[model samples]
Target: METALIEYGNFLVAGVTVNATESTDFAAVWDELLERVSDEQKTATAKLQKVGVLMPDAADEGFTYTAGFIVQGIPAVAALGLTGVVVPAAMYATVLVEGPAADSIKPGFEYLHSTFIPEKDVTPTGVNLEVYGPGDVTASNYRMYCWSAVDGVESPI
Candidate 1:
């Protein structure tokens, strides 16, 4: 496993908060979220790489899932039915996850939270990002980059 550290800023994204758990039908949720993001992008004639952000719920073990895309500027949050999220400037451990979106995401995150951060000398800030790359996105050969905020400059191998 190879890694890169990057300092990324916050973003305004159009998304919905879903109660997601281990048994959730993730594929369905992702399909709708991706489609919604696509529609929002088309309607605005704006574009950016789509992302699925997993934020831990304060009340439950499940996550508050936000599926959307990053906007260059502040988006019309209310008008577009999108919530503004400040990604906050932070360092991240980036890893490439390539394969079908459905299959790749779960294990990718598992590695990040379970193995990557613990094995490296970094602290998880709890904000994780799933960056979708430009390609035949849903295909088995698709590509994505998973980034997790950390507190140190430790090498993420």
Candidate 2:
């Protein structure tokens, strides 16, 4: 329900992603992700999301995306065997997602991409972010911040 221009520093994430353009249940993807995370994982942030956008006119069945925690290094999470992705510093149109990790998470991104981005007249960098709190997936007390990668997008909302 809030909007702002936020800056993030580089961090490592070992996780997964789905081409949002494809027909997929994003919530289930996150559930599968939870199983892959190592028990000893250390996170730089409570939670975060990273996505790669495909270029227009690009040849592909779907777009590219990545999701995971903010970690110190890829080696730190090498045990998980997940492909590591580094989130770089950039300004993003950020929004907060409330409720359960399995439920609140997906829609948060949807709001930013479907409503926030276009409303701002800004092109998504294709690097999306989601911030999560301590614990596993559920419908209890969980918080996540969904961020859209954007460059110099101004908002009046």
Candidate 3:
């Protein structure tokens, strides 16, 4: 996976959050979230995109992940029984992954952390963002953007 360094503005998102450990079933977590947050909620947004925000724990054991929708402004998140997040504006090392989500996401992430960041001499902020399209995710050729926020870019493309 090749990475491109790009800057993005702050994004407002609201959805259900989960404390994800190694044992957590991500598919089930996403399923439950999608169940509670309707299609209307997910689509009625400023940016028509769904995102998975991963914030690593202080000890690096697990992550607090939010399955969310990019919204326009202050939303009534509590009324919908959801949590809101303001993804800060920053420079990101991004990779476009195309394949089954199960087969692609983890390996792409590993490549970024273990190879790209280290080789490029960039410092990770420990915030990873997954931008998903409104398509058949279970399909073999699902597409998504995986972004890792970094402090500095050794080389920007």
Per-candidate alpha-carbon RMSD to the true structure: 3.6, 5.0, 3.0
**Which candidate, 1 or 2, would have the higher TM-score against the true structure?**
1
Across 1-157, the per-residue lDDT of candidate 1 in tens digits comes to 5566677766666665577776877557666755655464565624556788877777756677777767655545555556666566678878889888778877887888788878877888777888888777678889888899888774433
Alpha-carbon TM-score of each model against the true structure: 0.78, 0.65, 0.83
For model 3, state the Cα shift of residue 80 in Å. Answer: 3.9
Expressed as tens digits, the lDDT of each residue in 57-138 for candidate 2 is 2354445555555556767457666667666666787887778866775687788888887887877776666665556546
Q: What lDDT score is found at residue 103 in candidate 3? A: 76
Lowest-lDDT window of 10 residues in candidate 2?
Answer: 49-58
| Per-residue accuracy of model 3 over 55-150 as CA lDDT, tens digit each | 886578877888877766764665456678888888888888888787788887888889887886889997898888657777888888889999
**Of the candidates numbered 2 and 3, which has the greater TM-score value?**
3
Quality of model 2 by C-alpha lDDT: 0.62
Candidate 1 clashing pairs, residues 3+ apart or interchain: 10-87
**Which parts of model 3 are misplaced by more than 4 Å?**
39-47, 57-62, 76-79, 154-157
Which is the leading candidate under TM-score? 3
Which stretches of candidate 2 lie above 4 Å from their native place?
17-21, 37-61, 118-121, 135-137, 153-157
Query: What clash pairs does model 3 have?
Result: none
